[model samples]
Target: MEFSIKDIIEAGEGYHIEFKEFLDKSFVEEVCAFANSGGGRVILGVADNGTIKGTHTDNSFRSRVQDSLRQLQLYLDIEIRVQDNLIIVEVPEGSDKPYACSRGFFIRNGANSQKLTRNEIIDFFQKEGRIRFEELRNEKAVFDNDFDERAFENFLNMAGVSRSIDRMSLLRNLDCINDEGKLTNAGVLFFAKDIDFLMNHAIVVCVLYKGTEKVHILDKKDFKENIVENIDNAILFVKRHTNVQYKIEGVQREEIPDIPDVALREAIINAVCHRDYFDRSSNVLIEVFDDRVQISNPGGLPSGLRPSEFGRKSVTRNPLIASLLHRINYIEKVGTGISRIIQAVDENKKSSVEFEYNSGFSVIFRKLDRTSEADLGESSEKTKGKNAEIILEAIRDNPTVTREELCQITGLSIQGVEWNLRKLKAEGKIKRIGPAKGGHWEVIDYSC
Candidate 1:
């Protein structure tokens, strides 16, 4: 926060900096605004017009300022410093927000401190993490009309909860439903079918672009299923469009993706778990270009998370949603997602990951070049990628994806999908791991 006094005065006031000729009751209001929003500095001896007007920094003046600030009951403490005739007052962002002086609740909007209306104050509280959306009950979501039995059952199995428990007791234990028989937002998001109808912005839209820019679209899919399903399908969309090279190591075969799927999956899960469901204007997005893959979600880092401690600390905006994902093993633990993504990318040594935040959070993965692809494979020359590769990617995306589901994913007929499945099995590229009814496909091949 150290800065040149001359430069600051010349630059005038901004969002985080204000200038005042002297300390007054309104000066306390400015401090209140700064504490309510981002912490800022107010120069006591400088006028609003940037003229240097010398003011006293004696004990009497400091006592007046301290008394006025105490009226706000602010957790933010102000620090005073003297630079010649100028007095610098440093206001820290409040640990307990909604700070206000006798005037009213004021927030710094650009260079000015504006008063907050009742609705604005409520919105501010929500933004400040006071009112959480996940824990709120959605009275509109009827249990019978919106619930997905299969999805709920799958969740129970994945979470290791027994079906012997009554439905109400199970849901209550999971904190999905209230005693009033209404579903929580977390419950609806975790098990509701066609969730977009209830929560329109609760979806993930994936797109594959032709080049580095967003000019041309090659493929697109919208996932409006349950939150967990949205994460899974969004990941599948990525693998479906990326490049992979097959390699041989003794008796074992490996399929190395151009970008690490582990990192990508972690990013996707992080987006869904941390996205601001309060925002109806934007949905989670997965965009793939020729050079990199990007995943974005509405709302940046939460209030408690500092920019410097981003990857090192974990602060989730949606704790219940994170808990559900954690139970299903979609999230191994809280706060380790960023580190895991970094670890996966580092180990793969093909692509690198970058993160950006502010109003929105985005994770970008730089693609490995084609030369690296050739180096990892059998020969320098490229082979023509066939249906087998797409099928294998689909299998990798979801080993439990059924034949009929394969037809939808591949845009192929039943006969065509069966033929490729048989061919892949006969060639020792993939195999059915269990009985036909509950089986999954496993890849063991060196073909692209």
Candidate 2:
């Protein structure tokens, strides 16, 4: 294959190479090295003068490379080709944990190769999952407008900022609104009520498809509103379709809730905060399938994001929007929604969070039916329901419970009990019997 010098130049840092006389054991070692790192090209049969001299074009040369790969512990998708008498083997970095050849584990260090110690190797694998999604920069917005007064105020409210905050100061802190009054893509996304009208590319679309087919539209809503409203509206849209149960406490306790509102809210916030606003045609899509729900946004993973890095690193396609959302408490500061969602899903003892970066970014929340012991197998012995058990125990103690009764039983405030009741009812776990005077708590699912 022909290589573009201009593309190589534009690709800038992180791309590396090693030219060889012919296919050899060391050459195979280099192939594994490139595969372990963030991937780069290896050219052969070319002189240092940038002139192609060609390589041993026999099938053996290719066989040796393939054999070396098989011998290595980790296997990944590697691309091998030849162009202009040069043997170019493309190694895609493997994500199946630590990979090693005869030299043990290795990593690319600023255009040089370095051997990884046991600790270093462990750290590398850990970091693959510890990536955050908020640290990405919007270079295009470095010199653009980055603040909207209403967006800033709304963000502060969502983030739980009680005190008054300066709009310019907040923008400067987020690095979206520069001193020149130019807005970053983030500023446009967060503040502009009609971002789609202004940026066109910043719109978020939430669609509820009848099936996988795109031709039939069961229900769809486009969010051209400001980023904050877009996030809230999208979440409400999901909640509109989502259901949950209520678990009544008393002599015969029960668990109910078709779905968790918090889970839906988190999914919506994540979709809005991390979406690739750079893609013009595509918007953030929330497709509710019969068995599973898929939340997708245009644009593949961020530059430094990998599948394993799903919930770890802070990367953002629209950094400004993320920053504002962060301040407003829509998402956690360090990008902890993924872990929180995992925790919540585990608590429900159902559902699995599936992440994909193909074509566009997608997070699929599957609807699970069972509460298996294996769901908490990681820590099976631990008490499963602090929240669920506490509430259930209180209701078991008293069936004619009021908000005050719930508070006294669960040691929570009336407001807290009300919140939990709302959540429980949303989950389909419980139902109120009658009027406040003669009303009783009705447990929905006695199975739990």
Best-performing candidate as measured by lDDT: 1
Q: Which stretches of candidate 1 lie over 4 Å from their true place?
A: 1-126, 370-448
Per-residue CA lDDT of candidate 2, range 1-448, in tens?
1335323322222224555666666665666666655456667775543445688757887777677667666777777786655677777767664667875766543333455554655655464332222222444443324335677676656654434334554444444444455564556666654465566655667777543335456778887777778777887777666545556677776644334556667777777766655456767787765345788877676554557867875444443355455545565554567777777777776577777787687778876644333332212323324545567556656767666555445554333455566666777777787887887777775433
lDDT of 1 by residue, 1-448 (tens): 2336775565445555789887777888899888876577888888887789889878887778778778775556679888888788899878787776778887664456767653555555676555458767886799989889999989877876545556765665455776577888888898887688878798899999875557779999999999988999999999999888888999999998967877988999999989988888999999997668999999998755678989985556675677668768898877789999999999988788899999999999986544533232313223214556778998988999887677566554444566668867898999899999988888888485
Most accurate candidate by TM-score = 1
Candidate 1 steric clashes: 0
Question: Model 2 lDDT vs. the true structure?
Answer: 0.59
The lDDT values for all models are 0.77, 0.59
At residue 373, candidate 2 shows an lDDT of 39
TM-scores for every predicted model: 0.57, 0.46
